[model samples]
Target chain A: DAGVTQSPTHLIKTRGQQVTLRCSPKSGHDTVSWYQQALGQGPQFIFQYYEEEERQRGNFPDRFSGHQFPNYSSELNVNALLLGDSALYLCASSLVYDTQYFGPGTRLTVL
Target chain B: DQQVKQNSPSLSVQEGRISILNCDYTNSMFDYFLWYKKYPAEGPTFLISISSIKDKNEDGRFTVFLNKSAKHLSLHIVPSQPGDSAVYFCAVFVQGAQKLVFGQGTRLTINP
Candidate 1:
């Protein structure tokens, strides 16, 4: 089975612009979470979605928002992107109370 | 303050030897700990993990040890191979929070 899939392998956006990244979770998995990894750093939790609702969020601001569809696919939206918003956007999927499997990640560059 | 920390930024080990990566966490609420290996341009891959209740968990040549009293965890790879070289991240999972808090990763280099 396809583990977890994310779209737009790489993206370049200017400051103040908005960007959206997509993810399709692994089969039979219901939860999707987003993470941001800066250069030379580990992945930082952004938020998690369960049952089409956001269940948990990290310290990230509201500029970072997400949506999980009924089919279990997910989307991450960043409004008014700042240069600091540049990072690798990773999407992970898991079953309830199961280990998460990650996608290849979308490399976002906010210039 | 960072909840989890990997003191070593990188480590070099000879093939056929043991490679140990260490991590420490400040949050006592975390019940599960995980390790993830990553290569350039790819997402982290889940490795072995241990729960707070257990001190050790083993899988193949990789073993993870957790010391709850010390709030420390470590990953040991026996007979390390060149292919085992990658950036390893220590992550703590809270029981009900369902999000991973990751430490700054340690890059492991196994030289042949």
Candidate 2:
């Protein structure tokens, strides 16, 4: 019954630095999706991973990418971050076509 | 352009009164709609969802109404509680797509 869990509740990085965020989905869920929520904004989908492959993506740039492990855990990697990249990174999990359950989110502050 | 929009940035309601949050989408292709409640520093929690084929769906104190013709959706919370005060987001998806298009979110405050 454990819901989606994400690591590193908050982090600070300088511009041009690379950062990695991790997520472990809720038990019994398969699909994993990543989202970015700017201050006072709703989450914008980054991409979705199913069967270890990225099945869908959003309007984000190539600098943002992710990986899903065999255990259904996910990692979001951002390369050469910019100041605009500062936001709360959320991880959501769901069964195929089911409602997504979101984690607490990692607050990334790019200076 | 924002496909989904929640025009109201904030709303206040008295406890035990009805609270209505509105959302509108410009896409006619959206077939499913959902409402999510989120507290500060936490991710959104699913509140209610309605399919395009249905006009209304109710669960406990929450009811979601959809007007496909107008491309609008609404979430009603009856007998609102203080615990229900949070930012509410309206999300939409197409029939076959897994990605959701979300509104800007409305902050609801239920006063005691």
Query: Which candidate has the top score in lDDT?
Result: 1
Q: Assess the local accuracy of residue A54 in candidate 1 as a C-alpha lDDT between 0 and 100.
A: 98
Candidate 1 lDDT, B61-83, residue by residue in tens: 99999988889999999989999
Worst lDDT run of 10 residues, candidate 2 chain A, spans A93-102
Q: Which pairs of residues collide in candidate 1?
A: none
Local accuracy of candidate 1 as per-residue lDDT tens digits, A6-97: 99999999999999999999999999999999998889999999999999999999999999999999999999999999999999999978
Chain A only TM-scores, each candidate in turn:
0.99, 0.99
Off by over 4 Å in 2: B95-97
Query: What is candidate 1's TM-score for chain B alone?
Result: 0.97
Number of the predicted model whose DockQ against the real structure is largest = 1
Write down the TM-score of every candidate.
0.98, 0.98
Docking class of 1: high
